[model samples]
Target: MPSRILFVHVCIVVFLFSVPLAFGAQSTADVPVTKELREKALKDILGKTKELPKIEKEYVIGHGDYLRVQVYGEGDMAAADISIGGEPRSADAPRQGRGVKVQLDGRISLKHIGDVEAVGLTLTQLADYLKILFATVFDDPVVTVVLEQSNSQRYTVMGKVANPGIFFIDYPITLVQVIARCGGFTEWANSEVTVVRKGAEENKLFKKNIMKFDYDDFLEGKKVERNIFIKSGDYIIVH
Candidate 1:
């Protein structure tokens, strides 16, 4: 009787200790996606600014950027003030300022000035360049350049996701949410994802920001740091 009682007590003790072990072993990564979690992430990413490394204050114009240029004095040469939706105007109609988009080749094509190299130039730099370019055509052309839209802040997502392509980093987004935005993963997708961020210096050789993400902790809604803040030119690979 004593031997049987001791065995029962030992079994109960083992079961009690094993419960914690099992729970501890279960990572939050396997938790299912919840509305609350997504809402929290959405709130966190939106309305946040991701500063570029090194030059945190400056916003350099790059490929796929849209800019608005205004030229004063001697009238609007390129219709700088033309509204989008208005009746078709005659050749003699008043011209207004216009917005220009930076092509994939990092060049901007103005009405008469042709292509202007815009990549790597700030708004001020581009304004000065435009002034010089327009000076030849107009008498003392005072130019102003403003960034209308920034496509240079786009990030690339590839591998395992449904729609893998370049996605604009309109706001600060996390790795996991970005994957969802790309249409989630495929059947053969792996839980691990890799992130590659470009260095700030164009010429200088520097270490790339390479990080890994484990999707398991995310599944259980547990506090995990797998979700990282992404920036422009950052690439995410979900394998």
Candidate 2:
């Protein structure tokens, strides 16, 4: 009887150990990845490989925008000028041309032309318009314009970056280039990035993951959607 009891106890122990292995093998086999399953996994890993956001060519003029205007044949009118007090004046103002303000309405008071709209129009466009306006008084007037101080053109970079300050972007800039300007990411930065832009009614948000692919690949047109062109006043947050 003692021998039989010992044999039964040994059998129970063996059976208990074998039960886990059997179930583990069966469970793994039952969960075999099919062709469809493999494809789905690849898709999830690769993410959406479609085109990224294109760099846009748009700008808005803001306050304290220094402008240099030159009228061919009119030496007095053709000079380096600054927008002071929402008024376009010669660079050599009474007080060294300081304390100038560009109005939100985008209007600049010119000597001959009163209240010229300078915000919406580019420097070149403003020159053409000025030529047309000056043509009424002077014949065959040639006009040239250049931007000196771009106080209103700026973008903000925050969160996880070495330098989280407002950057002045005069022209269109890419996400990778902008990050480089900000001194790269911090140690605890999350791979995901976001941009908040002011819309017509509310703000819009755009999110991207930086860890999945190389930043160079995204900037060099591989994933265009990830290389969005940053606009003035847009905020980039790298969590």
TM-scores for all predictions: 0.53, 0.54
lDDT score of residue 13 within candidate 2: 99
Give the range where candidate 1 is weakest over 10 consecutive residues by summed lDDT. Answer: 88-97
Residue lDDT tens for model 1, 46-117? 635643234245678987666787786454333333344453253223222236667778888776687888
After superposition, candidate 2 runs with Cα above 4 Å error: 1-60, 76-105, 199-224
Candidate 2 similarity to native, TM-score: 0.54
**Which structure among the candidates has the greatest lDDT?**
1
Error of 2 at 209 (Å): 16
Q: Which lDDT value does model 1 have at 187?
A: 91
Model 1's alpha-carbon lDDT is 0.72
Write candidate 2's Cα lDDT for 1-239 as tens digits: 99999999999999999999999986764474665886677667767794434534434456656566656667535223543455434222221232223456776665565566777776656777988988887876777766656777777877898878777665668877888888888998855566666651332223232222245465466755666677777777877
